[model samples]
Target: MANVLPSFPNAAPTARILHFHDSIEYESRIMYSRPVAKALAHPGHTENLGLGVATARFAESKAPDLHLSPHRDNGDPCVRVSMLSAVLTNKALLNTANSSLKEHYPENFKTRNACPLDMGDLDRLGRWHTRTVFTLGTPDTASIYQREISRLVSLHPYLMHAVLAMTAMHDRFLQSSDLPNFAQSTAIECYHHGCAAALFNAKLSSQIDPLDRNALWATAVLLSSMALFFVESSDPEELWPLAPPSPSHLEWLNMNQGLRVIWDIAEPISPGGLFHDLAQNPQYSYFQSKMTSEPQPGIDGIPYYFTTLYDLTPLSNARNNPYHAAVRTLASLLDVECTPFTMVKFLSFPSLMRPQFKALLKGKDARAMLLLAYWYAKVCESQWWIKTRAILECTAICMYLERYHSGDLRLMQMLEFPKARCRLLRSGTSRA
Candidate 1:
């Protein structure tokens, strides 16, 4: 202040401007604004931003109710949609992988061989390949948009509800628009629609009466039929009585009695007998046609099909009968170890011998005792000697006794012996 010098006001202002400009120029020299802005503007870069945001939101949301740990947040509709889409797409990927394996390694693709491949390695390869292929066609902007949408959905349940409601409404509108043509469809189409209607009605009926005995029985029968179909398709020989005795050989035999019972009860009430209805229905006509196209000849030149019954007892009882002779011939053809003489005697002699034996001993009832012994001997000698066959025979005998004698406890006890229990355990462990 003591050394005050005369100075123009404009001079001070100019100096200050110069100092500000120098600082600005220095800061500008080190900065790269254009490249940074371009990167932020780029589609791929934007997608990364969107993905990050979505992931963060998902991480913050509540877990879902499932057997496995929740894959995404409960509140995030975007995540749910993404996960569902992924699951669907994964199925397609699996199909592609299967096709590829079939094409390149046909022999290895068979059920026997395919069971042992390293699934983890295959999955990794499949994921990498699918991701690379998808990336090629996808635009960064679209990817970014999808990512952002997914994130938004993941965070908001209302958005998901709205989307689903809109979709359902649109579908209803389309369906209503086609109402005029619905009744004028062809017979086949009409039948298909009727079946669909029946199924829908059945579902509603089940929901209304959850514990309906008939409905439960129907479902059980349906499941059993499907199991039989799979078993039959895998090995047609199982359906034939000709198959040699093995641990696995008797499974169908064991199932036969239950299947018969199911058939007996459900057949009358069902639209028709299950197989008969299936054969007649146009929807299943193709499958029926395939089954009938190459009918296999059974014993006595009879064409074998699912519905055909081959009763050995009746055939064996008719002495000097052509069918009896045919049974022996069939046994020989099947390489089963059973003498025709023994088979004939077992069938015919037992019925004759038991009554006389019973009359002789009033206190012990010799006839019933003799019948039991004879039946046991016949079972031991027959082609159905396996554990499964024994179990099946036991079941069949139980059914016969129940139907004819109102459930004989003695016969039931005989069926549940320690020997049968041991056989069952052994059979359960052994495989074909």
Candidate 2:
């Protein structure tokens, strides 16, 4: 999978960095999810697709109706993948993997290194410094995640473990093949995270100052992204909903919800805290603004086909409708423009989904899946971590809904939009 990083995208960089009132820089991406099947022309964990502005114009074009193609009942989805990348290149990505990251994030490198580790662990830390850390957040928060958070590693050992664990998990995700090395790397990933979580939990049980609070918040963010990247299979059927239920099924959503726990406990709201900078980030503020401002009381912006599928009548509301919250949130997503800043609104759907809606999705409720599918299609190509998980899950949802719910014309009709949109996402890898 790491092999795909250097060559996949051929699209000219349509993404232009925008400056906010605060003069903060944010990058615009025409995102496509990483490869699963022929979804991306390259193999790897992140779908850093070069979907240029032209593709965005195409995304806005009316999609033709497409039926659900049959799902292959057998092997790994990526085994048949023959995508040849156009060599996805950007200034940051063009940097050699072995190059020093300190120059890019000079603020984060502490005078003292994380201690008591062998060279193997140190190598992983180096990889994080060079690549993994930079891609962890949006352009605005990337610095905070890479620079400010790294400085915290020395003061909070658990934060160091969390960073190592995330780096290891990223390495695990990048491998296209399932070798003995895959299992070994996975074990390493688990050990570091387990240690991080243990120490973190211990610290939370006691007193925490503003600095500890910031460290814990940053660690939680890393762990949360890791929790989502923990894949059961590259194939959708082999994953949850279709696969038997376990404690870990859709645990990413649970992890998403769990982030607030640390946030509430560690109110890193104190001035000068690292998280304070994160809180002030324009990307988040923009998302919260639209979320709070979108009018509700009905799924007004949601298409009639989806409204009918969910049984959301004129009289129905958040109190009685399971799909109410999810649909309402989806409407808010639709209400905004799909800018780099606004895409955060779409990616945040899982966290905002109500428990009843989440349960319906866990049960493979077709309506719920349709809603989720639409959300996935909208933002699948946007972020590295999201693209990490979105590739397979989005592909699976499209296939699953098409195969089983084919008879329901309304469901299939609504499904057409996401399916078509997802198709466009696949092509985004090479579009110029």
Candidate 3:
């Protein structure tokens, strides 16, 4: 039998009991969390028929997946929910089930404490297992998403929930127009969103390990992507800079700062870590190397005059002008190809951004807003999570600039790129 470690060794007795109970519930919901051959009887009520024992045996025979149940949802021969009910009635039933589960699932207790997944949650997880994970990055990094992330999910429930939250939100976005039952699905997705973020935030406050560091970093990426998933209306007039400042304004930008903090904590690029090879191409290393307090101009992609608008000069650099870093960093990308690898690198720029740059964007600084509009115009179609908000918000920025800063021909001239770019995006034309 595999040794099931105590989930919370130093936790209070109540916490330990609750953790045990939740572990049992996870087994019950995920089709025999107790994958042992022994029949667990609820003290006295039912005979020990061991109907699920054979299914568990078959599951074990096939080499079960760590986070997922091995057996099919149907043909249980016994309904597992009955075991959950038995545990509720008799507190000792969990010990019986826990011992039974020890043979199969040793390290699953911590990650399975949440309420059991319904059909929708199951569907979302399955989609992630099969599809969404692959899309999060390039195929070269598939091992990180598939192998490393699964290993992390086995160790950290927060990472598991964070992955689920991203998949759920992705699923929600895909089905928003077609699914008539979106409101119901949204409620479930919101539960995932809440648990994933709340637990993740809590975990960030505590001391962590190397593996924990990886898990936290992975969760931060998902959270950042999720931050973009929750924008308000598609209307440009309702968005920030166009409308009055609201709490949601510049959320994606601010969320990136959190990602940077976790990145420092995680040291993903340091030797031996899972994300050490995040820069898939040699050319992309300029992004990691070129970050300087004193940066020069004349870079490509964003117009030369754009940086000049912020009064970026040798004396200013990033020290005096916030736009210098934003402009300089964005300029690095013009030479790199926008493959799946670079796309991930591309989206992460906000994290490396100077706080003041993001602050200026939040304050609706015309220069900052203009620069951001150019960025969105460049990458609006780079990834699915970025596309909707990027396209919509870029258009909003253009309108805001045009509406408020109309007389300035320099600002108007700059608006032309993002305006034409967003027009192409909405028209379904590919920039590449």
Candidate 4:
């Protein structure tokens, strides 16, 4: 009924098999694999079983050499089916088990010819994200996010696809060389499918329960991260030729705000939730203290000028000004994580800046433009991969400022301050 195993038009034997076991349901199926049918085709098995005509057809592909081994842990008869034949062509089994397999199977399928060091897709991706991607922007979210994903993946297809998509992109980004043609294609497919699934699920956004709300928020965070990567990889200048009223950065920020709305709605469900802890985490406090306190700049440290540059600005005492606050926050981000730059490039100054700040920049407010230029220079120095694009942005900001406020010597001086320091702050320099 449902073609669980992928069909090759050229009839080349498949090296992969999808082994599924619904422990709670005591149900299992191997797509297009004949060993299952042979195990079930024994004497007295037919009398106690619901053997339809499909079983007889499936038995045609049986291999006599195959044997059912007892499960090592449970002593249950374990079936190892080969995907070399057309046994699971029975629509009944396929339709019944399709959804279960897609959701519950962590890797979705097992490869028969996997080498000893070859971790399956889900396992490898999950570990990598836990280690790297979680800290790419907001840190300390990995454990809770990963736990919720694993817990809810069975009941939520949207979240499952989102995780898969993020993992694919993360893998692609980390690879030094080009991904194999097949892997490249598969990763692209995963991303699109995930986005589609997420959009489909959004239709029922109103009816999701508290538990599902957590899953939704988690999915939103993952989607936002994926989108960040998407925006970074696809040059924004090319995407927004005319620079629309609401740019991609604003769209990403709005998406993040949606997560905040979800968190507000779901807060009553668990007052001391993971998201709550993340918001009020001690690390955030430490980061703030590190920012507000005086800096002890070493020889190779971020220039002493950068540490106090925000305090010297006209907006320094304007504590309530979002643009001023954002500049200070970004300065701290650079100071805290400048050396051994890893995920710093993923930190988007635009994403952190409020709409009011963005409006100031768009309106050619000289001070805002100056601060933005400084931020971009720090961004450029943070990661080599993002350097060229960041430098282009910095150049664009400086050119725009020169066009509008070239007579303002102070603004020009402020713009140059961070750029000069960025030139000096080489990568791998020890933190102050």
Best by TM-score: 3
Which of the two candidates, 1 or 4, achieves a greater TM-score against the reference? 4
Q: Each model's RMSD to truth, in Å?
A: 34.4, 17.5, 11.8, 16.8
Better of 2 and 3 by TM-score: 3
- On a 0 to 100 scale, what is the lDDT of residue 116 in model 1? 17
**Preferred candidate (lDDT higher): 1 or 2:** 2
* Residue pairs of candidate 2 with colliding backbone atoms: 1-44, 1-176, 7-85, 7-87, 8-85, 31-381, 32-381
- For candidate 3, give the lDDT: 0.56
By lDDT, who's the top model here?
Answer: 3
Where is model 2 poorest over a 10-residue stretch in terms of lDDT? 21-30
How would you encode candidate 1's per-residue C-alpha lDDT over 1-432 as one tens digit per residue? 011111312122333323322322222221212344234323344222111101222223222222233554566888777666655554444344344333322232133222211222223223222231122111432233233323332232222112222222222223432211112222222221222222222322222221222332333222222112111111223322223443322232222223323223334223433244434655434323321112123334432321122233323332422133323323332322234223323322222222233233222222233233224333332321122233333333333444454454544444344235434433442211
Over 243-304, each residue of candidate 3 has an lDDT whose tens digit, in order, gives: 78765567566565555455555666666556567654575464354222344643334556
Candidate 4 clashing pairs, residues 3+ apart or interchain: 1-90, 1-91
Candidate 4 lDDT score relative to the true structure: 0.40
TM-score pick, better of 1 and 3: 3
CA displacement after TM-score superposition, residue 262 of candidate 1 (Å): 3.4
* Residue range 147-171, candidate 2, lDDT tens digits: 6665566557567667877777667
- Which of 1 and 3 is ahead in lDDT? 3
> Using Cα atoms with residue i matched to residue i, what is each candidate's TM-score against the true structure?
0.20, 0.64, 0.68, 0.51
Candidate 2, overall lDDT?
Answer: 0.53
